[model samples]
Target chain A: MNFLEEVILKEGQALSDQVLKVDSFLNHQIDPQVMQKVGQEFARLYRSEGITKVLTIESSGIAPSVMAGLELGVPVVFARKRKSLTQNGDLLTAKVYSFTKEEENEISVSKKWLKAGEKVLVIDDFLAHGEAALGLANLVEEAGAEVAGFGIVIEKSFQSGREKLLKKGYRVESLARVASLSNGSITFTRNGQEAWSL
Target chain B: MNFLEEVILKEGQALSDQVLKVDSFLNHQIDPQVMQKVGQEFARLYRSEGITKVLTIESSGIAPSVMAGLELGVPVVFARKRKSLTQNGDLLTAKVYSFTKEEENEISVSKKWLKAGEKVLVIDDFLAHGEAALGLANLVEEAGAEVAGFGIVIEKSFQSGREKLLKKGYRVESLARVASLSNGSITFTRNGQEAWSL
Candidate 1:
């Protein structure tokens, strides 16, 4: 977590102190060794959860989620944001509202991948408004699988994602929790760190 | 490579005997253990290539590509299919026609991640038309990076991807090559395997 925080401080771009962009290390451009560590941290957190599958959204979530799956000795099932030509089957679909994209995307997972009674651990890179996590939980339920828990690399605590999931009775773990990103600065809740400007 | 070949024979779904669906383990629902083997295989193959980075596209390629990145101790930079909200920078773009989607998509990579003179190893899940690999190669060149080679998990040998890359003078390595997928039967180039039906 400290390493991740340090990397965020160094490489992550803060957009107007409101949006944290990690394209350099987390999402678009990836450091798989660091991602391996993130996955190991998640595995350590959910060691006794009996996780069978690691669920995530397509594109950005695949890296950290798959890393967690490898560490947990589980398979990773990512919900496709759009139906592709090669993807043909009965799918579990859920509507996810992205605050950043300002739209609703119906993400889907093939029914063949997530089976009934399987325990799923949802993983993603960032948790902002909890839409993706909730949507993935919906997909898990549609597959007749149970949501074991959720693992997130970064959490914007000023946003209501964590609180929403916790209110929904889901155990959510985020490695880096940001208290506020106001006025071109980032503040952490637990570490009680100074507000670092971009 | 034999392990991958065996897995393709065992779990890979034969769609119309022409389209091989590896959603069970490779792409949709990923078996990270198998992907680890895939990463190891790539590392073993490109041991002397001095690969500084692993390049892949979004969606399916992230898993094996990042696995290879972790194994090879390099960063994985995946090309984004669409420009997102946070992505605001100069990009190296390439046009890829998806034979599956029946459309052309312009994939872009940030100019920051891929720099001049870096050794890049391209990785992907499937190679059918070779558009993705070719487009990635173009992006690499645009970034002034050299494409060390390309690594594919599965190759539809009946298709033109392999021959095209070979013609382009790129060293391509496919873990499993299906020579024919006629009449719902899959014949491997190396193993001379059975023709499976969905």
Candidate 2:
């Protein structure tokens, strides 16, 4: 297994079948080495996409997105979940429903940061229901920019996030794909097929 | 002037006598190269402190903290500004009041991420009223850890943040220290003395 897949199996906690908490390395408590590798992997995959800017939602998505931006020598723009006091400019916004929070939040990007005709790569930590990626893509479209593709850290194959994005004609690259988290065990999808079932 | 100071002078907007908007690079939209340098600078500043972990608030603080963590070969823990569904465990929380937003937010770090007696370097994007830094320090103390020092990207030197932290015996290193933003001009502090009045 790849390092990411191995990390998931070893460090990731399966709270339930629907929830895989990777707070130890991916989100809450971050391992910078893993983030660097994730950045390199994303850069390698999307190197030829002519990406001009990297777009992501705030908080969890910032690290990986910034690493990829550094690798690509580009700027990274994060959509704010809440409007701050100093946020001044025309804003590009979209509504995103969070499966985890079970709520809808309006995510926004400053229009000044995203220019027309720019090729943007959308990045996020998880792909559970596709709402965030769709929202971020909507922001890029609102700015008259094109979404080159998406780089997701972890994709839940049991969910329809990937299928939905694929149906919308978006290229997606997920470093680790989980087929199932049944019986308190983590099983990853390999070669688009079911692999070692723990 | 350093790269960060140059960027602030060229790109930062002084909204009023009290607010300096650096959303163009530091906070909202981020420059990866600048962030990389900021990380390197922080790592260099705190190299001798024996920092076992890098702690910061979520969203804006994640990038620089992760970069420093990568340089230091340690884990970076970001306190959540808002709670999420999967955040389960004993939590170490502190209430932080935002002078800009004029609201109070309870930032929380998982008890599991922080261990007693670990040396933590507190990093943040800005130091204004010292509320956020104080809140983060409170978290470190609550977790039974020792705070090595603070690494601030930008500091409003006219304000009381540095003085307050210093009075509490906490070491602070601000990369760009703005002496004043009066008359829509950015003036910086050099060697603890006011300099470059524009």
Candidate 3:
């Protein structure tokens, strides 16, 4: 299995039947080496997309966004989660819901950073609900930029996040995808160990 | 004068007499190229300190912490600012007062990531009020770890944050120190232009 898939299987905790807590390494307690490699993998995956920038939200997504930006050699712009944003120039905004926090927030980006015709790669840690990625994609579209694709660290495929995104005709790639979480056992989509090793 | 100092002098804005907004490159909107250089400088400064890990708070500090971790080739752990953290083992927490946000938050780190006797290099984006850095240092200490030093991207030297950290006998280094902010002009600690070119 790839290092990321292996790490998730070995270190990720299945809390209850609905949650996969990877805070020990992927999100809360970060392993920079592993995160950097994740970025490199994303960069390799999106190398031909002609991505001009990497975009994400604050907090958890910052590390992976920075690493991917460094690997892609592009500036990274993160949308700040705010209660509200006054209508202003050069600002693109959208509403997003946080499944983990169970709260909705307004995410926005300035017009100066994201320009017309620029291709953006959205990088985020989790894809449970896909609201965050969708919000960011909306922001890019509002800025008149094209979303090259999305790079997510972990995707809960049991949820409709990926299917929704795919139905909308957006390209989405995830490093480690969980197909099902039954009782305490977690099943990954890419089950074969070799699927991860390469 | 350092490269970061130069960029601050050129791009940093003085919103009020007490605030120097560096959203153009540091926090809100990040310049990865510049941040990578800042990390290199910090890595060079603390090369002999025998630092085992890098520590910082979440949100703004994540990018710089990750970059610094990459340069130092160490793991980076961030403290999460929550209204409360359920008292539990495998967690080291501290109370930090935010002068800007006008609130107090309980920041915690997983004990699994920080170990007793390990030297930690604290990296942050700013040193305003020093509470964040000091709070992170407290987390390290609570984990029974040692603080190697603090590497800050910007220090509001006009405030008491740096002074407070210094009084505690902590080795604190800042890439850009704002000596004074009068009207709309900012005077950097490194006054000469050559200070930045170096």
- For each candidate, give its TM-score against the true structure: 0.92, 0.94, 0.91
Quantify all predictions' global Cα lDDT against the true fold: 0.85, 0.89, 0.85
Candidate 2 local lDDT, A53-124, one digit each (tens): 999988889999999999998999999885332444688878888878777888898888998999999999
Task: State the fnat of model 2.
Answer: 0.94
Candidate 1, residues B1-198, lDDT tens digits: the string is: 367777887887678756898888877899999888888888888979999999999889999999899889999999988533244559888888888868888888889889999999999998998999999999999989999999998999989999899999999888888888777666678645432211
State the lDDT of candidate 2 residue by residue for B11-127, as single tens digits.
999999999999878788999888888899899889999999999998899999999999999999999885332445699888888888677888999999998999999999999
- Worst ten in a row by lDDT for model 3 chain B: B189-198
User: What is the TM-score, restricted to chain A, for candidate 3?
Assistant: 0.93
* B96: Cα error in model 1, Å: 0.8
Better TM-score candidate (2, 3): 2
| Model 1 bad stretches (over 4 Å) | A83-89, A191-198, B83-89, B191-198
- For lDDT, candidate 1 versus 3, the one ahead is 1
Q: Give the per-residue lDDT digits (tens) of candidate 3, residues B30-135.
A: 8888878887888888988888998988778888878788888888888888877789887888999988879889999888888999999998888988888889
The DockQ values of the predictions, listed in order, are 0.82, 0.84, 0.71
Q: What is the C-alpha interface RMSD of model 3?
A: 1.4
Model 1 DockQ (Cα-based): 0.82
TM-score rank order: 2, 1, 3
